[model samples]
Target: MLIDTYGRVATDLRVSLTDRCNLRCTYCMPEEGLSWLAKPDLLTDEEIVRLVRVAVTALGVTEVRFTGGEPLLRPGLVGIVQECAALEPRPQLSLTTNGIGLGRTAAALKEAGLDRVNVSLDTLRPEVFKTLTRRDRHQDVLAGLAAAHEAGLTPVKVNSVLMPGHNADEAPDLLAWAVAHDYELRFIEQMPLDAQHGWKREGMITAGDILASLRTRFTLTEEAGERGSAPAERWLVDGGPHRVGVIGSVTRPFCAACDRTRLTADGQIRTCLFASEETDLRAALRSGAPDEELARIWRQAMWGKKAGSGLDDPSFLQPQRPMSAIGG
Candidate 1:
């Protein structure tokens, strides 16, 4: 088992399949998406599987999450899922999607052994959705959620980024809807990943503020016995199986319990979400380096893991890359 210098186990890995996304959400991508990684530069399906194998078998990784600019957009996503499912001690396999193309791909994903899904949705109102995403596919996302439920992906998780003045007012309504549908709802604090794209500290909404607002509407009971590397502070609403989670990566960072590492679409290993430097694993992998040498490289990289992201530190400079590039 590989443990970083900070004492966090390397148990979960988020692999970004591509840097390209269909929607240009203000927080994630620029109005015009940045120049994308060249086709040959992105890790192929086979390379992704090999990396997953290394992470799980050698590094004690127990959970594998496929992320993206929208993982479903990748052509060989189902095949990749199939390969991940065949691992010896099969890790808990999941995917995070924008739910745009899920209507056509959810069934195939489930058939290929995906265990769960988390969909990114901010508002229930169509116009607000369009204003937020710059796309008029609100109905399509709703349809995709329904399709996922029909395909037996029960209690699908919905991820909502709470942005002040934009969708913060919708928290109560969103939680109520989640309770009705028996889906887990998570409220994420907006981070400063793309500061140039209008991410200001003043424009941010904290997790505490969100919880306080929700408490006014429903009596929230803290969930006990929650486990693993989950960053969310889980709570249960009165008389519902619906769990409300707050991912306070910004206002209340979870750098202490961060057990996850990320692999960019091009095979760079990022130890932290806010990390500016990345270890070039693709170059080493493609160069026919021996397994022991690759393991040594991984070890060296993990040793250099920073103590914390220090997001609130005034000295912190926003990463030059966008969230899409880093697989947030």
Candidate 2:
């Protein structure tokens, strides 16, 4: 197993298939669509599969998640999922999508061996959705969730960014909806990663506040289980199969247990989501480098991983690259 300097195991890998997205989420991208990575720089499906093999076989990676500006935008996503599922000691394969195009691809994705999905839905109101995502396709996202459920993608998760003035009031409603549908709902506190938009601390809705508000409506029982590297704290409502999770990355950073690393669409390996530094793997792959050499490069990159990110640092300085480019 490749343990970083922080003693964090490299167990989870989130690979971005593309930097292109269909929606312009206010928290992710700028109003004027941001410039995308050059097509030539993005890793091919073959390269992605090869890296996954190295991550699992050589680095002890047990879980692999496909992310992107929108992973479904990648033409060969199904093929990638198939290859990942076919690994010798097959890792748990999952995906994070905006759900704009999942309506038509859900069944195909499940057949291709995708184990689960997390759909981004910030609001249930159509106008609020349009204002948040700059796209009037809330109905499509809802349809995508139903389609995913129909396709046998068990435990479908809905991820909502709880922005203070934006979708804060809809928290209980979202949780109630998730409980009714038996879908795992996660309300994430907004981070300062979107520096391009001049994010302020006041704009954030703390996890404490959310839980306090939720406790008034639902009897939340603390979940006694092995938690993942994610910052989300899990809670089981009174009588529901679906659990509610609050990802307090901003107010409560789980940096010590951060076992996941990200690979950008252009093949740069990021040790942390809030990291500004990255190691480029595309250059090595394009130069006809051997697998051993590639692995060595990855090792070097992992070895240099920092103990914790600067998200909570008083001197925290946001990187020029937006959250989309970082594969958040």
User: What are the Cα lDDT values of the candidates?
Assistant: 0.85, 0.86
Model 2's alpha-carbon lDDT is 0.86
Residue 258 CA displacement from its true place in model 2, Å: 1.2
Q: Pick the candidate with the highest lDDT.
A: 2
lDDT of 2 at 201: 77
Tens-digit lDDT track of model 2 for 1-328: 7678877888899998887888888877877847888887888899999989988887788999999889999999999999999997999999999988889999999999999999999888999999998888999999999999899887899999877677888888888898888789998888776636577776578899899888878989878878868678999888555589998887888888988878898999998887878998889988998878878888889888887777777788777777777786
Question: What lDDT score is found at residue 123 in candidate 1?
Answer: 93
lDDT digits (tens) for residues 1-328 of candidate 1: 6578778777889999998888878787777737998999999898899988888887788999999888888999999999999998999899888998889988988999999889999999999889888899999888888778878776699999876667878889999998887778999988877635567777678898899989989989888884456889889898546689999887877777788888999999888888889999899889998666666777678778888887888878787767887886
Residue ranges of candidate 1 with Cα displaced over 4 Å: 195-197, 226-228
Clashing pairs in 2: none
- Stretches off by above 4 angstroms in model 2 are none
TM-scores of the candidates in the order shown: 0.96, 0.97
